[model samples]
Target: MTGNLTRAEQKQQTRNNIMAAALKKMSEDKGFSSLGLREVTKEAGIAPASFYRHFSNMEELGLALVSEAEDALQAILLDAKALEEKGEDIVASSVQVCMQHFRDNGPLFRVLAREATGNSPLIRRRIQRCLMNLNHQLAEIIELEMRRRHRKITNPLYIAEAISTLVFNLGIASADLPYAKQKEAEKRLAHHIRIIYWGAEAMANSQHLSRNIMLS
Candidate 1:
């Protein structure tokens, strides 16, 4: 027997379908500036009037997509961060998780990459806010790690922001790469992130050493 959906469930399903259609249409080629409400609704197999029932405008739908993508990205990174708390390999695991996420959500990331460079001021600002949140979460994690190890970072936020920005900006290309090329790209990303972390660790340790020397 087919179960009928409640009004709220139907509304949510329609919203999800609209967002899915938008993501499917979004890519580096089209960019955010070109997406129209009618086109999205058409792709979603719904009437243009129905789209207004869900999102107020195309920008609102795009922002919702951005919010969803950012949440997924943050969750993947946070899961990796959780593993680090258990003494597991952090950088490699995080890179793997990122690659997996990109592979699974290539269209979404492509949309993000295009939107980041597109001509829409509103979309740009929304993306920036999303990045800021991701950076803040990473910064907090880094600060805790440094404190636990009795080290002092000059600017954990800077490091975290740089890393988060790099991932968001460069990860789009990985989604389009072939298997071998994707592997190479992920490896390079892992190495670069490891280098950044190690560099910060070295600086923090040097500060610790100098403070000890001064105290003695």
Candidate 2:
């Protein structure tokens, strides 16, 4: 099947295979920090030495997985944000899409959520970096929306960090619930996000009013 692909494509395929194998191992109650190279290589159907070609070591592989999760999450959040321009409820839209993504890519997301506080400091730091990246991206999006509405917030990054933390925490929680309960989780998440936005807007208005009063 890989015969028709170019050399670069084949290497990418092997790299994907290695990552998949690692995910599979992690899904079975094993943390990435505890996984051995030989076990992962065997699962990937590649020789142990071949692993070095893709990743320097297990830590590097774990970082790759984190990178993939970061990209997937950014895409999901951006897609939900885009819906807000179309009159869709961004909170509900984001929850529904994010939950669906968790369902579709459970292992990938589960690893990310678990490793965020796992025993490995390297993995934990990488996860923190991923969340920080998401926070900044989300802040930019929120800033644009605020500008569009002629609104001002003291710091969009704070709001972004709050929203990102809440959504990710709730999203991970929802992943463990059954389908019916997941729906309830979605409602809770959407409600929480709305409240955050509402408070932010109220503060911005109050600030605006205070400035006008002083000017008057």
Candidate 3:
């Protein structure tokens, strides 16, 4: 069922296929630095020189893959956010979303998490941007909750950043560790979130009480 295509359309399709193959290979193996262009080209079933036509180098290709992974993760988390607003427990919904995402996209997450910490400035920066975006989204949610309660949020950004780090680490740890270890880790993570939320609520209440006392 081969259809006729314009030259540009065929070239674009080939490039997309190459990128897809490269992403798949990177997901399977965490060591992106060790991957050669020739190997990727072979896996992609394209000439080695053809790789250069799509990307300047393997690092460029890796950055593209990282971007794709970031988008996919954002989509999953956004869906979870929608669920949270519909009477779902926030922490439970978040954990479920993360677990499902990891189960479905383990390879992409593995590659990004493993290589983003290395010497590649581009990959590192892209990963950092993704983290920042996540933090911003969480901060907005926290601020919205605060507003709903008529509470002032003095450090929502910092709180969001901390929570974002916690969530990211939870995802990475759960994905990388053994099955038994992952279960234990998830329990610990849920407990940790509860403690954090409880402490914040207590602090907010104390602050309110102190303000009332001062007014009196």
In the range 74-177, model 2's lDDT, one tens digit per residue, is 77867867876665656656678888877767788878888997888998998998888888888887777777767767689999999888877777767878
Model 3 regions more than 4 Å off: 1-13, 24-30, 146-154, 176-186, 207-216
Model 1 lDDT tens row, 175-199: 7788899889888888888778888
Error in Å for residue 47 of model 3: 1.7
Worst 10 residues of 3 by lDDT: 145-154
lDDT score, residue 132, model 2? 86
lDDT of model 1, residue 119: 85
Clashes of 3: 0
Best by lDDT: 2
Ten contiguous residues minimizing lDDT sum, candidate 2: 84-93
Candidate 1: residue pairs that collide:
none
**Clashing residue pairs for model 3:** none
Task: Give the alpha carbon lDDT tens digit for every residue of 9-100 in model 3.
Answer: 87788777877777667766547787878878898898999888889888898888788788877876687668656756666667666666
Of 1 and 3, the candidate ranking higher by TM-score = 1
For candidate 1, the TM-score is: 0.85
Alpha-carbon local distance difference test for all models: 0.80, 0.85, 0.74
Clash pairs detected, candidate 2: none
